[model samples]
Target: MKKIMFTGGGSAGHVTANLALIPYFRQENWSIHYIGSVSGIERKLIEELPDVRYWPISTGKLRRYLDWNNVKDPFKVVGGLLQAYRIIRKEKPNVVFSKGGFVSVPVVIGAWLNRVPVLIHESDMTPGLANRIALPFASGICTTFPETTKSTTPGKSRYIGPVIRDELLQGKAERGRELCGFRRDKPVLLIMGGSLGARRINEAIRKQLSPLTSRFQIVHLCGKGGVETKLESNNYRQFEYVNDELPHLLASADMVISRAGSNSIFEFLALRKPMLLIPLTKGQSRGDQILNAESFRKLGYAEVLPEEQLTPDSLLERTMDLYGNRERYKETMKAFDPGNGIKQIRDWITTIMK
Candidate 1:
């Protein structure tokens, strides 16, 4: 039987694409193995699949800032490299697929050392530190944004657009409304602050909840530990995080307020949901979210609100603006073609294996 090794982790964004692709390989009778950090979210997500064997390895955070962990992280990465190399050697996989997170770097290098072809999927407009390091070793790079191709090695990069989970497209709006106990009298507004939650966005949204909820039924994904138990309202509901119910919530949403993560924004684009994008500032990241948000803005699918300018009043104004002009955004999004990313990437893997 053919075997494939997969690696990526740290955030849900890194592993979600892999999740979208896993079912296909399983149906084709391929042996699937996953390598990820022992304690990362990827382990939990991947382990839930019965057929895929999950391997835990040492992994270090790849930070752009100076820190004492910088001194110790190299050792962990080296250990991960050695572990990954041994695993690849023993498994003798036909290929390795990476989703581009810090944990993926060692696995890509290990695949190269093992003489196995590796394919990488980069979700950001620009390659992150891990993908940048793995690019040289990868046989091919798949990008979500057409603009990303300019930053990658020529001929190696292909723009496949976004890989969306099939389940997300099958959500029922009525089910979502029932779950939130919301009536159809008002349009539903969904606010997401990314996986870890955005404190400022949370504060701003809560501060204006009374006014906002008056106009729109609200579903707030508050991220981990971000939910406020003291707050209560008939038209407003909050979740710390969602797994299976996300699609339903998304289906019921008439508009979205979210952080500009590429995977997420692309999903919104695919769903034709108008958005208000609040990207993470450069201080919080490498400014990739800023680029992602701007790309959407230029395409007329969303409105951008820089974090520095974010306030309760500003949030309310921008959200109202998004709702007012939502039809235009939806029309623009309808013109977008996300392509068949899952099929294209699967074809690439099949070709490389042959």
Candidate 2:
């Protein structure tokens, strides 16, 4: 059996995507092991998978600033490199796949130095700093957006679209609506801020709850670590997080309002749900969210709302416009092919092993 190692962590989306590809690997009878940081959300999720062994490594942020903490980052990176070297030497995998986050950086470097074949998947229009830094050493780079091609180093890139799990592909939308207690004839609204949840988005939703709940049933995913629903109503259903139920909720929604995180945006695209995007604006994350949202909007797939001007009233108006013109959005989704990306990645792994 070929030994395959996978590295990526930080968020549920990336971790779940890694887990989703497990069946494909198993069917081919490959021996698979996962490596991630003990600090990330992967620790909680990866422990549940059967027959998959996991190892932990210390990782550090590649801060984009020149500050006191930035001085400490290199030390963290060095320590992580040492840890990753030990992992690669012990496991001796034929290939390593990365989902592109800060934690994956040291593993990428270690794998490359050890002559391990590395494949990277960057799920955004603008690749993350970790992936960009790892690009020069990657044997192959897979992207979810066509626009991402420009951001990568030339000669080692492919466009395979988004890799959505089977659940989202075959899930019943109407069943999700019913589960949320939504009317069969009326449309449903789905709001997600990602695994950690978005406080600002939740706040806006709270303000608009009265009006939104009146016409549409709402499925809101509050960030697991953030605020809970303060308002209670029959038309609104809330979850701290949805690991298994995401597909049902995505399938059931007529429209979605969310932050333009790369993973969440692609999930909407896979479901072909019309969306209004509110990109993140605060903190150290910078303008990457806005860039991704704008790129998708330019493709006519979704509408962009920079957080500066994203008020509850404006959001409501934009959502109403999409609701009134649902046919156009449906047509947009029909033009997209959501399958085969993950399969392509799986095939590439098999080819490399041979």
Candidate 3:
């Protein structure tokens, strides 16, 4: 069997697209190996897969800010590079697939130095610092949006859209209703703020829960350590996190309230779910979420409510607006093509290996 090494992870976003390709690669009978930070969310997630081998390496986050860690991280990056280089030399995988994160930088460099081809995927409108650093080493880069093409090396990049999990579209609304304990009267509103929930959005939802629950039942995916048992209503259900039930919850919902992460927004677009997006501000991120939201709004797939205006009133008002304009939003999403990039991506992986 041929061999492939996958490297990506600072967050679940970096790993999920790779996950979408895993089962397909398994069916094709390839030896799969993953290189990631020893303690990253990626190791926890990828370790659960039955057939893949996981390799841990040192990694330091790439921060754009003036962080104290800046003094120490370069050494870690160097250490990671050495570890990755050793792994690549030993494994001799035919190709390396990266999903663009700090951990990916060392792996990409190691693969390139070892005479292996690298394929990178960037899910954001703008390339993260890690991907920018790794670009010179990659053989090709796949992007989630057309706008991202201009940000990459001209000929090396292509707009292939996102790799959405097939199971997401298989969701059953009846199953969702049963899980959320819905009585079938009010519409369901699913609120998610990435893998780790957004405190601002969570607070706004709880503060306006009384009024909001009157019109719609809520299925809140409030990341780990975010559940609140003190405030409970029959119309509102809160879970710290979700995995299997996510598709059903998404399918059952009339609309979404979310952060503007590219992977998530594209998933919502694929499901034709109208969204009220509250993007992360500059203080929190490099403003990619803001750009992602603006693009979605411009495309008529969603409405944006800036973080500065994330009060209970604003959130509820925007949600009401999303609900009112849902059909128009759904129509826009229906017309969108996030591309069947998974097949193309899989083909590229095997072809590159060959």
Instruction: Give per-model TM-scores.
Output: 0.98, 0.93, 0.97
> Positional deviation of 124 in candidate 3, in angstroms?
1.2
In candidate 3, what are the lDDT values of residues 305-334, reduced to their tens digit?
Answer: 999977888888888888998999887787
* Residue 140 lDDT, candidate 1, scale 0-100: 94
Cα lDDT for residue 55, model 2?
Answer: 86
Residue 94, candidate 3: how far off, in angstroms? 0.8
* Residue-level lDDT tens digits of model 2 in 1-354: 788888888877667568778777878788888888877888777777776888888877777767787878788878888888888988889999988778888998888888898998888777888888998878988888887887788878888887877777777887788677777877788888878888878888888888888788888888775545556567888887876677777888889988887777877887778898988874537578888888888878898877788788987788788777767877887887776888899887767642
Ranking by lDDT: 1, 3, 2
**Which 10-residue window in model 3 sums to the lowest lDDT?**
345-354
Clashing pairs in 3: none
- TM-score result, candidate 1: 0.98
Error of 1 at 354 (Å): 6.5
Q: Over 4 Å off in model 2, which ranges?
A: 66-68, 227-230, 282-286
Clashes of each: 0, 2, 0
